[model samples]
Target chain A: MRISMDLELQDRPGQLKHVLTPISDLGGNIASIVHHHDKKTFRNTVPVSVIFDIEEQTLEELQEGLEKNGVAIVRIGKMRLRARTHILLIGHIIHTNLRETIDEIDGTGFAEVQDLSLSMPAIDGPSSAVITIMATGDEELKKSIGILRQIAERKDLLFIEPLDERGSPGGVSNEE
Target chain B: MRNSQSTLTLSIIGFGAVGQGVATIVQNVPHIKVVAIADSKGVARMPDLNDVLARKRGGQPIANSNLTALDVIRTIDHDVVVEVTPTNIQGGEPGLTHVREALKNKRNVVTSNKGPLVAAFDELTQLAYTNGVALRYEATVGGAMPIVNLIRDTLAGARVLDIRGVLNGTCNYILTRMAEEALDYDQVLSEAQDMGIAEADPTYDVAGIDTACKVIILANAFFGRHATFADVDVTGIDRITQDALQLARQRGFAVKLVGDVQELTVSPKLIPIAHPLNVSGTLNAASILTDTAGEITVAGKGAGSIETASAILSDVLSLMRDRT
Candidate 1:
């Protein structure tokens, strides 16, 4: 599988090679290594993104191997997932913690709130927000919607979900 | 008869409980053939598997050859090698060497042994990848409970946040009995040993080493995190007092030996009775906290000769599917 990992490394003579060796040892073929040594911090740590393809189980060993060797992994894999779906949430979007709402979706590990746009005319008036979600696939997207629906109900807000192309009347007309 | 499916030859190393169990199940399968069998006593070419099993059941050696398990793996002409040897944590031993030989020979491997995987997970898995062979060990973690396959096959793209499992059937049985009867750890352990649920030594199971191995395997399989027995913060149920169980019971909780991969903890923890991890008896369960599926829990018989053999069969069938 192809995976991209963001790592912070010390700007030493062989710091980059030290991080790259584990990936190679664990049967991962390094695709690219982007080192930002020019933007090294005062502590001499540079942010690097390494892309590699590895066997399924090797990925875990590589991760542990890296951690054991003191390599700081910021994130692994693609930040944006496949299959994007847009949904709208209405009513007191900000009053109910918007960060929590986003986190609830992001925490699922299968889906994330990729982008959001919110509008509130008055402080007391009901607000609306449009959220674009990146999910693993259809089934995961459905689960994400299910969680959002429950949150919306408990928060007493209106949630307009994404229209399913296969089940929607507008989609049928467009197909015809 | 002309057919599209290919017949796969299999070599079995370590003719113990798990090895015999696989042979028993494969008796009904026509596509897979057992060509070679190796045990501590000797190694033999078993073209007629029924006769070999009959000899083994009758307390006679299958054959007398000077071949080591590694030697059979190297010289044998088989599509796959099923390694069912005992686990040796110190250095992953004969099983590790056997696995390496099998992968080097371009043969797939399905094993119930935890030693090699725990000792050299990265190197062995890397070897398999380099040699274009698959190494599957579903029976290593939860026996027939399907913990490894559930996370690896079903939850493919789902990112796992944390994994908590009742991985050891022996520990689970002891703790369950201790709580249910309000008995001491020693009493419950003796009962488990009498019932064949635990080994005579019982240190491996009761001391949390077995559970630690399972959690380590899960950590690597899901989170790509490698951990060893030392990494797990282990606290066994031997010190759990009856009063603690009773107090937890009053508070609507049950004491369970929970193994968490993310935290690398294997200890007796208080879980609500209604929780999915709160399973009883020899049943093993795993709760996988994934980003998309939320928390998915699976529970079943964790260890048994036939049950584990069923997992081995599943891995064998998986290999067949990939080859076809």
Candidate 2:
């Protein structure tokens, strides 16, 4: 599989060479690197984009090996399935089993609720949550949404799914 | 060595061993001063730090002021608050509230307690960022091993793929004893208790809750994952038999209470005897996996008053540098 990872490297001599040695050791072929020399991250680190290809199972070990050597893998390329999209759930979020709601989607392995932000106005008022979910492809994303829709229906919560190319009147952002 | 120009008036909450350790070390340092100290009884505001040290060393009580530590943080003129309170896993009390108040009041915070971070990491980190103050806890996971600062400061640019460590000193001590002397679990527990290495209850350390908490903290700090103790799959070393250790040793491996963030597990695992995580005795070690650097492992004394205090001291210095 062709994979790309956005890595932040220390701006020091020989740092880039130190990071590339691992990919070679893991039997991966490097495609290209987009080094951000002019730009520094908020943490004062240099960001380097590396694209490579390796066997599928070796990906896990490659990630673990990289982190063990003090290299920070900030963002992995298509590490999950396809990409991530955000959806909003309105009404009594806390009153419902929010934990279970998130866990069931995550349990699928194909999709996970990667991020969440909830706004609870009052004790009696309904709460709203923006949950970011990741899936491998468009089909899996739709399937995951279907599963979440059923969950929202059972709990009587409002599930505002992501918008398509048509862009409905009430549309959620399709990040992917 | 007083730098009155850059002096940071500091207060310490929870005047326990770790707090007292920080208090004693900061007396000789120039850039910081202990303006307030609080114990379970009450807080004592600016009582000649030397006298407070003497009283604590002599097992004497320092006179309490009318105000509590929380009140002192709000009312006093301090630049930073050092929180070394005991761990309360359930609600993350006292330490959680203390850290929140310090950040909200716009004071830099350095803490050794894992409870608050384990309980509400994103909330506290976001609070610190919003308040424009440093919330540092170097002593939380690996005690004096410099785990947090190693990732945050030294390895700034490295994208940490995952972190694996033997975080709890008490568990490491017990496991080391079992492997070295062919001792049983119960025997090592009592010996550790007698030596003051393990607590009398030993549940927190023995049952892998402490390691799990450290793993959760690493998950939050490094991976930006909002993980709790419940998220860690824990398996303590209390169940490891001497036979198992001998078998592992014979197989060129050592039984270790390994904490891994990628796996989200704090369980007794078999590590090769040659591995960096095979640290013995009270020593703690952390291995960071990154794409660029391969594997960088750090090992040091995981817990102690003076040791943990040193980590906090560096945090205070880091906060001071950021202001300049």
Work out the TM-score per prediction: 0.64, 0.65
In angstroms, the error of model 2 at B265 is: 0.6
DockQ for each numbered candidate: 0.01, 0.01
lDDT score, residue B246, model 1?
A: 58
Model 2's DockQ? 0.01
The residue ranges of model 2 lying beyond 4 angstroms of the native Cα positions read A1-176, B1-5
CAPRI band for model 1? incorrect
lDDT of 1 by residue, A1-176 (tens): 45789898876778777788898888777767899878776666898988766665687788888888778888988423545555555567788999999999999987889787665657986665667776755567778878987998788665544223332222111100
The alpha-carbon RMSD values of the candidates against the true structure, listed in the order shown, are 21.8, 19.2
After superposition, the stretches of candidate 1 with alpha carbons farther than 4 Å from their true spots are A1-176, B1-5
